[model samples]
Target chain A: MNVLFQILFTISILTNGDIKVPNSGFQPGDKASDFDLKSVDGKNYSLASFKDAKGFIVVFTCNSCPFAVMYEDRIVELSKKYGKKGYQVIAINPNDPEVKPDDSYEKMKVRAKDKGFDFPYLFDDGQKVYPAYGATKTPHVFLLDKNHIVKYIGAIDDNAEDASQVEEKYLENAIAALDKGKEPVPAVTKAIGCSIKVKSK
Target chain B: MKVFTAIISLVFILSASKAQTQVLPEYDTYDSLSAAVFRNNDTTYVINFWATWCAPCVKELPYFEAFNKKYKEQKFKVVLVSLDFKRQIKSHLLPFITKNKIASEVVIMNDKKYDTWLPKVDASWSGSIPATYLVQGDKKLFAEREFANLEELEDFIFSFSKYK
Candidate 1:
C-alpha cells in the first residue's frame, strides 16, 4: 500500500507539477525572467537596469492589434501614472515583424514617437521574452514585484471598449494592492486580443 | 426637373448597393453561443471562432466554408462565429462576408468578456483566434490552434462525426 501511494504521488507530481505547455512559460507566483531586448529609443533594456524600481508593469502589445491600439493611451497613462509611484511600465512588442509587417522595428519607433510613450517600448527580437512569460495575446500584462516575482498577469481592465464604462480596472487594482503590500485579488485574468504571431516554421 | 432626376439616381444607387448586400450576421452572447453549439442533439456542431483581423483565421475560412457545404449533407452544422467589434458589423464584416461569398452561417460575437466565456467554450482555449470547438451529445473537443489545411480540419470533424 505504501509503495502504491508513493508511485501515484510521483506520477501526479510529474504530470501536474512540471507539465510543459508550449508558449506558456510562466504562471502566477513564478519568478519573472530577465531579458535584454532593444528599445525603440536606440538602447538596450533589462529588468536589472532599474535599480530603484519597486516593480514593473510589463505589457506585451503590438502596433497592429486593434485591441492593443485601443488600449495604447491607457497603457501610456498607466506607465506615467505609476512611474512616480515606483512601478515602471516596460512595454514589449512580441510579434514577429515577418508575420506582422506593421509590428516591425521601424514602425515601432514611429509609433513610439507618435504616441509619445513615457516608457520603454522594447522589441522582443527573435520573439523570446513573451513566450517565456507565457503571454499569448497582444495587450497582455504581467506585473512583477521588486524581487522579480510575478504578482499579476492579465488584462488592463474589464471593459476593452469604452474605457469610461470600465468598472474593474484589473491592472490598476493590482498595482494599488501591491502598493499597500497586499496581494492582488484576482492575480490572473484572461486577456482578449490578437494572438502573438510566431515565426512560421 | 433637376431635383427629380437627382432623386431617381440616388434611389438607383441605393438599390444597386442593396443587391450585393447579404443578411448581416446575428450577434450572440456567451450563453446564446454555447446554447447554439451544444444543442444536446446527436448532430455534431463544428464551431469556429474567428475575426476579420486575424490572418490565419481568414486564411482557413475557405476550408471551413467547404467543410460546411460538405457537412450540410450530413449530420453536422458549421457555425463561423465572428469576434469582430459590434460597430464594424456594417462597415467591415458585412462587406467582407458578402465579398467572400461565405456559405456558412456567420454570427457576430461582440461579447468582450473573454475571461468569462472562454472557459465556457473550451477550458483549454487561451483566448486565441482560429480556435474550433466540436460538440455532439456528451462529447466535446476543442482545438486552440489553427488548422494547417482543409484535410486537418476535415480529420477533426470526421473523428467527431464518425460515431455520431
Candidate 2:
C-alpha cells in the first residue's frame, strides 16, 4: 500500500507539471500547431498546404454571431489585400453546431459563397482547433508567421460594431510591421464578441 | 367638446405608457460605469457582462433574475451590464428588456475601448459575454463563463461570502 501510494503521487506530480490546460491556447512567441481541417469547398487544408505563404491570418469565426457577421466583409477584404503580399487568410468556424444550429456546415458553405470569400474557410470539426489556439470568442484572430510562430492574437481591429468607424486596423498593421521586419506594437488585443459555443454537458 | 375628450384620453394614454416604459441607463465609457456600479462598499455587487444578441447570455439571464429576486433584501445587488452596440440600444436592447420584464437593474456599456477596459474587469477575461464579476469591499470573484443555474450562481456568490 505504501509503495502504491508513492507511485500514484509521483504520477500526479508529473501530470500536473507538464499538461497544458484546455482552451488556454498559444500565446505570443509560442509555436502554433498546424491543423488539417475541412474547408467549405470540401477540400482539406493545413498550413503546410500553403507552400508559398509568408504568414497566415488565422481567424476563428462562425456564421451566427453578430460580431462575427459584422467582421465578415472586413475579413474578405483582408484576404484580398493581403493575399498578394504572401500573408494568406485562413478562416475557421470553431463553434459546435449542436449548441448553435445556425453554425452548421451547410450554413457555413452558404455564408462563404455569399460573402465571396477569396480564402479557405475551414470548419474546426469536433471543436478542436480554436481551443488549441486559445480562441475564446467568435472573430478572434491568431496572426502566425511562416514558421508557425504565433505573433499576435485577438480582434481584427479597434472596432467590431462598425468597420467604417475603425481607427486602428490591428491585423493589417501587424502584417505591415512584419513586412518591415518589426514586431506588432500591441501584440494582443480584446474585443467584445459572442462566446464560442460548446455543447452543454 | 369631442376634441376636448380626445385630448384628455391622449394625455392619459401617454402618461400610462410612460409608466410602463423601462428607463435604461446608458454609459458610453467604462470608467463612468465602473464608478457607478463597481462601488467599493459593503454591498456585494454581482456585475454580469452580457448582451441581447448573445444566445448563451440570453439563456442564462433568468438565473440572474432569480438570484437578484432572492437576494434583494440583503446587501446585494445584480447589475446587468449590456455590451450591446450603441446603435442597437433603442431597437434591440430596450425591447428585449421590457418584453422580458427584467426586474434586475440593466445598463448599457457602449465603450469601444475593449482592450483597455476588459483587463480592468479581470486580467484573465478574454472579452467574452456572460462573464460575471462578484465583488464586495475589494474581495472579487470573476467567472468567464455562463452560470448553469440559480444554484450555481448562488454558490459562486456565496463562495465569496466565505471570505468575509
Candidate 3:
C-alpha cells in the first residue's frame, strides 16, 4: 500500500491524472526543463539566460495563429509590465517551420521586429522542447519560479477576443504569486487556442 | 413608389431567411472516443464536435439542429458534443443549448484526462473543434477540422446513404 501511494504521488506530480493536456504540457510544481533554441535575433536562449529574474514566463506561441496574433501585443505588454520587476518573459515558437511556412526563421524575425517584441522569440525547430514543457497550443504558457520550477501553465488571460471582458489572467496571477513566494492560487487552467502544428511523419 | 417598396420588402425577406440558415457546428473537444453510440445505429451518425466559444461552431449550430429536426425521421441523427470544460456545462454550455433550442442530445465531456481517452478514438486528432465524422456500417468518414456549410455535411450524408 505504501508503494502504491508513493507511485500515485509521483504520477500526480509528473502527469496530472485529469488527462486534459497530453503528457506534453508543463504542470504545476514540476521542474521547468531547459533547452537551447534559437531566438529570433539569431542567438540561442535557454532558461539559464534569464538567471537574474525572480520568476519567468515561457509562452508557446507562433506567427500565424489568430489567437496568438491577438495576444501578441499583450504578451509584449506583460513583459514590459513585469520585466523591470525581475520577471522575464520568453516567447517560444514550437510549431514546425516546415509544416508552417510562416513560422520559419526569417518570418519569425520579421514578425518579432515588426511587432517590436521586447522579449526573445525562440525557435522550436524539430519541436522537441514544447513536449518537455507539456504545451499543447500556439499560445500555451508556462510560468516558472526563480528556481526554474513551473508555477503555472495555461492561458495568458480568459478572454482572447474581448480584452474589455477579461475575467482572469492566469499567467499574471501566477507571476504575482511566485514573486511573493506564495503558491499560485490556481496552478492550472484550461489551455485554449490553436494546437501546435508539428512536422508530419 | 409601390413597386420599389415591394422590391425592397422581397430583398429584405430573402436576406432575413438566409440569415436564419443553420450551420453544422464543429469543435475540438480535446478528446473523442469512437463512440459505442456508433454501434446502435444502422443509419449514419453525423457527429459534429463544437464548442460555444467557437464562432463558426455557434453559427453552424442551428443548421445542425434543423437538419436533425428535418431528417431524424429518416436514417439520420445529429449529435452536438460540446468540448467546453465541464465547468462551463452549467454556465455557458447549457444556456447556449437552451438559447439555441438545440433538439439533438447534448453532452458535455466531463473527462479531463484527454490524451489517454482521445487517442483511444484516433491518435492523429490534434484536438481542434469543429471536427466531424460520419459512419455507416463498415464505411468510415473522418473530417479532421471544420466544415464550410450544411451542403458539405449533407453531401457526405446523402452520398453515404446511397452507398450504404
Candidate 4:
C-alpha cells in the first residue's frame, strides 16, 4: 500500500507537474476582488456599488445545503443588523445548479422570497467568483474591510446545527471588532457543510 | 399464479429479514474513530466519509461494499464513516444501512467542529463528504471526491494492495 501511494504520488507529480488545485490561495488580510453579479432583485451588484459601505460580508451560500438552510435566518438577521453599520451581506450561490437542481437560479429566487432575504442573493453563474475566493463549502464567509481587504474567512458561527446553542458568533464578533476599529478575533473557523457543487469533469 | 405469488412474497420476506440482521452502528467522535481505524498500522484502511442525506455518498456506497466483500481474504478493511446527524440515526441512517445491507463496518462520526478534525484527517480535505482515505502504514492517500464506479474503486484498492 505504501508503495502504491508512493507510486501514485510520484506519478501525479510526474504527470500533472503540480499536486495542488491552483485557485485556493486566498487568505485573510488579502484584498478581495470585486464581482459584478446579478442579484435576485434583477439588479447587478458589485463591491463598488455600495458607496457608503464600510465593508462587506461576502457569503458563499446556496439553497440546497443543509448548513446553508440552517443559517439562512441568521444571515438575513446579520444583514439587517449590520447593514445600518455599513457592512452589507452579499449572499452568493456558488453551486452549479445543473448538479444540484434545488440550487438553480429559479430555486434561489424562490428560497430568497420564502426566507424574505433582505440582502442581495447572487448566483455565481459561471462559478468564477468562488474559486477565486477559495470558498469550499456553503455558508463559507469572507468578511472584507472597507478597502476590500479580507478580514475574516470561515463559518457563520461555531455552530450550524442549532443557532441557540451557538457559543461563538464568529461573524457578529468580526463585524463588532471591525466596527470598533480592530481586527477580527479568530478570523478563521471550520464547520461541517455540503461542498459547493461543481460541474463534473 | 397464486402459488407463484406466494413464493415471491416468501423470498422477499427472507431477504428482508436477512437485510435487517446486521448490527447497528455506534456513534464515535473523530478522535476515537481515527484511533480505532489506525490502531493496527499493518492493516490497510479504506475509510469512506459519507452521509445518508448526501445523494452522491449513497450512490458510491455500493462500490465500497463490493470492494469490502471482494477482498475479505486480504488484510484490507473498509470502514464507512457516516456524517449523518445523531438525531436522525434511528429514523434514517440505520434503516438506510440495513436496507442496503452494507458489508463494511459503519460508524457515525459525531464531531461537529469541522475545522479541528478536517485538517487532522487530511490537510488538503476541504470538508467534503463522499471523500475517501486510503491508509497503509506511513502512506495515506486522500481523495476529496466521489468514485465514478466500482471499477475505479477496485483499481484504487488494487493499486495500493499490490505491493503488499
Tens-place lDDT per residue, model 3, B1-164, is 99999999999999998865543333334333444356655787787777776555676777787778778878776777677654455678767766767789665554444433444444434444566667777665655555456776677667657522
List where candidate 3 sits over 4 angstroms from the true fold: A1-25, B1-164
As for candidate 4, its interface RMSD to one decimal place is 2.6
A75-175, model 1: which lDDT tens digit per residue? 98887899998898999999999989999999999999999998999999988898899888888999999988999988999888778878789999998
List the candidates' TM-scores in order.
Answer: 0.87, 0.89, 0.62, 0.84
Clashing pairs in 1: none
Report candidate 3's fraction of native contacts.
Answer: 0.04
Q: Per-residue lDDT for B1-164 in model 1, tens only?
A: 99999999999999999886676546457887676556788888889988887888898999899888877878888889998877788788888988998889888887787777886776556676888888888787877778877898989888767933
Give the per-residue lDDT of model 4 (tens digit) for A110-187.
Answer: 999999999899999899999889998787899999899999988888777778878888888988898888989888
What is the model-wide C-alpha lDDT for candidate 1? 0.85
Give the TM-score (vs. native) of candidate 1. Answer: 0.87
| TM-score of chain B taken alone, every candidate | 0.83, 0.86, 0.70, 0.80
Alpha carbon lDDT at B151, candidate 2: 91
Deviation of model 2 at B23, angstroms: 2.3
lDDT of 4 at A61: 91
Best by lDDT: 2
On DockQ, the leading prediction is 2
Error of 2 at A115 (Å): 0.8
Chain B TM-score of candidate 1 stands at 0.83
In candidate 2, which residue ranges exceed 4 Å CA deviation?
A1-23, B1-21, B162-164
